[model samples]
Target: MSALILTSVLGVVLLYLGLSGNKSILAPTAIVGLVAAGVMSWTGWNPGLMEFPTMLKFDQMSTLFNCAMIAVTVLLFLFGIDYYRRMEENVAEHYALMVFSLTGALILTSYTNLLMLFLGIEILSIPLYILAGGKKRSYRSSEASFKYFLLGSFATAFFLMGIALIYGVTASFDLAVIGQKVQAAPNNVLFLLGAFFVSIALSFKVGAVPFHFWSPDVYEGAPTLVTAFMATVVKTAAFAGFYRFLQMTAMPPALSDTLLVITILTLFLGNVVAMRQSQFKRLMAYSSIAHTGFLLMAVLANSAMSWSTLFYYTFTYALATVGLFIVLTLAKRAANGNEAIVIFRGLFRANPWLALVTMLLLLSLAGIPLTAGFVAKYQVFMLAIGAGFIKTAVFAVFMALVGIYYYVLVIREAFTPAEETPVLVVSPINWLVVSACGVAVVAFALWPVLVG
Candidate 1:
């Protein structure tokens, strides 16, 4: 626990350092700090506190999420190297904000109390609000920040009310104690309302349908790299907290049924809406929401393997999104920084390696076989079926097929030839980001994940 806290503090310190205009050291320092955190977590060294009065557990689950968060942060730092190269202004603040967000993410994964949970969410979100508006001169960026802040604050209020209600009933904010009360008598009306509110709060955080209104706008408005960070690292951390909440208190029968209905709706809506998107960034945002629905199904699986499934799915999904976003940034730069789907036309002819990398990433997102996305989706289906939710799993599989179609269209554009070819050159940093994601996705699919 001390080690984890140290890591979180160090990230905060790095952010302060970044604010001092030291662009050259920002990414490297963050990478090194994340690497250290990963190493400490891997060694299995930490205080065994039922942290925050038993609301959070610093056990295997928290450790797994910590490691994943650190890994993602490391990759983001690498991508940030080139992403921020030309932005001479606010360089320090940008890097610092990232570190602060990462610290919140770490806290989120280890939260033990409802108060801690809410704190973690705020810590994670406030920095992102600023990061979205990092481009001070861009109207779209400012719009994105404003939209995100308003929606995020609304969600946070809902979460706070839920926490208050839960505390009112149980006279405790500790998750374990709350779970005990729920299990003792599962039909309490106020408890059920609290649970529903909590679910809605987290669902919004992960961008589930009906509650996902801000994602596309924010993703489209923010810088490509910032969008990637929110989609991947911030999301994984949010889900970690959501997962803990579910595991601590199994939903009552009524709430469980409601979640089942909501999950199905989210999956359908996410896929259906993504099909009509023309902007690559917005498409990815909608697609990410769809992916979130798939993950929610895994969480609903309620099996021994749920944790491992969530961890692996998040890693692979993040791998694809992180890589795809990196490609989008570079491709956008090549096309005078446009975000249109057509910007990728003739990509294969212009740069085969980059195009192929993009193809693999899209393929993974679409859950095509031989890629991590396929394996991740397969695990989700198996978990759902194993839990006797065959109908829900079947519908999810159908949606998965639909998902493949849109992603393939993106690949088709990448392979299409342009009437007049233009030269494309990519930074080594972007190339490294693409290559790392490609390798990690394939590697995880081939190996048995450590989480079991």
Candidate 2:
């Protein structure tokens, strides 16, 4: 509760700083507030407590995710110092909106009531709608915003309707109550339908297959920084909320079967579609979808250790993504904002260190051995196999190999000589951010205890 309040206050404080025209202090102030909030979250680590009559619950899982969110945001803000340096206006609003969105993410990590769940999704999404259009002058940005708004509204409606149906069946909005009711009436048709609706809504949120049409377009259109935020922080929050919901409910076999189908579709589609993409952002958008498939596998396994595995997977994926996007931003600039795979050509020749870091990040994303991504994928595979989903595990491994093909393609471009030298510009803070992410990825892979 204290951490939530602190993050909320931090957002307002950033808005005031923006209004006061003190732009320089916004990032630093937000960083300080986030760190403090992270520390406060740790205070509620063990013996998880429920607050607001069970609307919110803070457990070790929530604390870990909260801290990871804060850490990722801090890295983003540090990178923002350089990314937004040239922008003269609305800088503070950008920071504030992100902080506000972070507040929503924090809520998601802890929400125990369906009402709180709805509120968290809205709070998290509304800011992103604006942020997606931050590049106001660009038509692509406007299109991205409009599409996300429309589709997100539809998803929210589905989610709300699910809540209504669950209430109708169970006469309660509290997760614990719903869990008790579900356990008592496991075969209730209305309850199963409600769960199905909720699952669809969350599938949309996480950019899973069939519902992932919006992601590649929006990612390509939005500002790269905002896209990074959506891919990392927002996705993490959605998955955490999804996990919480599933953890509370007594998932019927029908629901599990439904998830299994979605998982298979998501894995195959995300990996195969990505192979043909020339745009780096779009490729990554698909890559994120592919990862969602793996995460869903963990959820499907529903082992006692699923939550821990999920956290580790998301944390490592976020680290690699943050670093890769930072490098992509630089590459995009070098290519005059082309956003093509070709932009990475001659990267190694231009900046060996940057290229090396990019390699490590991409390798991690490809699930190469001895990287955090490998450990994450390996754990998911083991869990799925242990859960008796051998066929699904094998299919996922094949899709992972397909994913590696594209990632390696990009790495090849980085090493290949260019027809002409692309003008690459590296900001100090950007370099620091990428370096930190790279180091963290390798370090955490070797020492998983750091995350635990």
Candidate 3:
């Protein structure tokens, strides 16, 4: 908990530095702090309590997520180095805000109390509100900021209310206490209702369907780097929280059924909608939502290796997304910042390596065999089938097939030849960013111990 607090405070200080116009220092400073904090988190990671009075855990799961979040942010910071250098004005604040948001993410991953969960969500989200609109002068950016703030606050309210109700029934905010109370009276309606409300709050945070209205617009409007932060780090933390919430016995069979339905709806909505998207960012946003559904399926299936599955899924997904977003930023720069799929047309002719890397990412996302995605999806399917939800698993398989089409479309465009030479210029750092992700994706696919 102290580590979480220190990192967040460091982030806040950095944000202050950023807004004060120290643009060049923002990324480097943040990178160093995150790396140090990440190391501390890893070294201290074990089954133990920190700030026991406040109720937070620093277990293997938390450590893994902390490491993953740190790594993702490091890459984003590196990408931002080149991506934001062009837009010099808000550079400082942008990096600072990202760090602050990451602080919130760390808390969300390790939180053990309902109060801490609420605090973590607020900390994580409020900075994002500003980050989303960091463009300062763009109407769409401002609009995205306002929309996300309003909806995110509404979700937070639900979360707080649920926490209150759960505290009322369980007479404590600690998850441990709540678990005891829940098992003691498994049929308690108020506890169940609180759990349901809490589920709603978490669902919104992760951008699951029916609560995913903010995603496409936000992804389309917000700066690309901000979108990547929300997509990878924010989603991962929320799922970690969501998984923790469902671990209690109070998550009744009826609630489980409801979650299963949500899983299916999210999958269907995310995939079917993404198929029609022309914008690459929007396609990825919807693709993320669909992936949430797949992740939730693993959550509902509830196996011993659920944590491992989640770790692999989110880690690989984040890696692929960070790489893809970097490529998108470069491609958009080449096309005068156009995000359309057509921007990638004949990309291979202009830069075969960039195009190939992009194709590999899309293929990984599609769960093509021999990629990390294949293993991730396969694990979920096995979990569902093992849990005896054959029908749900089968439907998920069908949706997986449906998802393949859109990813293939992206890949097809990447390989398509352009009439003009593509002027794709990548900095050494961004090139390293792309190469690192590519390597990690395949490296994990073959070794799998990268996760272990």
Candidate 4:
């Protein structure tokens, strides 16, 4: 809870710094504040005490998620030092808005009440709507921002209505009360409907199939740094919140069957559509959806290891994603703003180390052996099978195989030769971030204990 206060204060501090117009200090300041918040989160864990009369709670699981997200946000801020250096306007707001969004993320990991859940999703999303349009000069950015706002508002309405239905039936918004009331969930049609509505809203936030139309467009249109935040921090928080929701509710037959269909569609569609993308950012957007399919499986499994596996999986994904986007920023500059996968051509010749690191990061995302992604997927499949969903697990494995091909395409481009290669300059800070992520993925893969 104190960590939440600190980050909220940190956001206001960043806005004040923005007023000074000295953009030079924004990233560094945000980084320091986030590191402190992470430490506070780690040290504040107490499972028995429900803070604020069950509005919030700090447990071992939430603490791990809080620290993991803070670590990822710190990496993004470090990357921002270089990503935002060339831009002259609203640089501080970019940093501040992200910090504020992260504050909402912290709230999500700790919330124990439906009201807090609604508040957390709103606080997290409102800033992103503005940040998606940060590139005011780009028509695509404006379109992305407008589309996200409209769709997000629509989802929020469904979410509020679901909460209202739940409150009407149970006469309370506390998760514990809902848990007691939902034990006979299979017989309650209204509760099942409410759960279904909530599921759709959370699925939209996580970019699952039938609700993922906003991702590719927004990712392509928004700046790379903002896209990285959307893919990592936003996703982790949503899943954590959803995990809590699942933990507290008894799954009725109707809701469970509905979710199984969504999972299969997400896995099938997210992988199949990604193979057709030519642009790097759009490819990442779809690829992200593919990962969501895997994670949705884990959430459905809901085994004892779900939280630990989620922390490891999402944290490693964040590492690879941040590094790849940094590489993209360099490659895009070299290509004169063209974001096609072909821009990666001759990357091996230009800088072998960057190319090699790029392969490792991509390999991790592809879930290749001895990489963090492999361990994450392996654990998810085990969970699914253990939960008696053998057929679903088999289909997921096939989808994961399909997912590997798109990543290989990017790797092929990076290693391919080009007639005239443009020089890809790497800033010192960017190089450090890329290398750190490259090392961390392999380290966590070899030593899975690095997470919990």
The CA lDDT of each predicted structure is 0.84, 0.91, 0.86, 0.90
Enumerate residue pairs that collide in model 2: none
Name the weakest run of 10 consecutive residues (lDDT summed) in model 3: 45-54
Poorest 10 consecutive residues by lDDT, candidate 2: 44-53
Give per-model TM-scores. Answer: 0.95, 0.97, 0.96, 0.97
lDDT of 1 by residue, 1-452 (tens): 55466666776677677667678887787778778778877675655642443645567877888788778877877988888888887776777677778778877888778888888899899999999998889999999999999999999889988888888888988887888898897888888888888988998999987899999999999988889889998889888888888876685777678778878988998898899989999999989999998999988876667888888899889988999988887778778978899888989998899899889989889998888998999999999999889999999999999988889889999999988554676778778878989988778777765544
User: What is the lDDT, from 0 to 100, of the residue 96 in candidate 3?
Assistant: 70
Q: Which residue segments of model 3 deviate by more than 4 Å? A: 19-21, 45-50, 449-452
Compute the lDDT for candidate 1: 0.84
Cα lDDT tens digits, model 4, 278-377, are: 9999999999999999998888887778888888889999999999999999999999999999999999999999999999999999999988999999
Q: Could you list the CA RMSD of all candidates, in the order they appear?
A: 2.1, 2.0, 2.1, 2.0
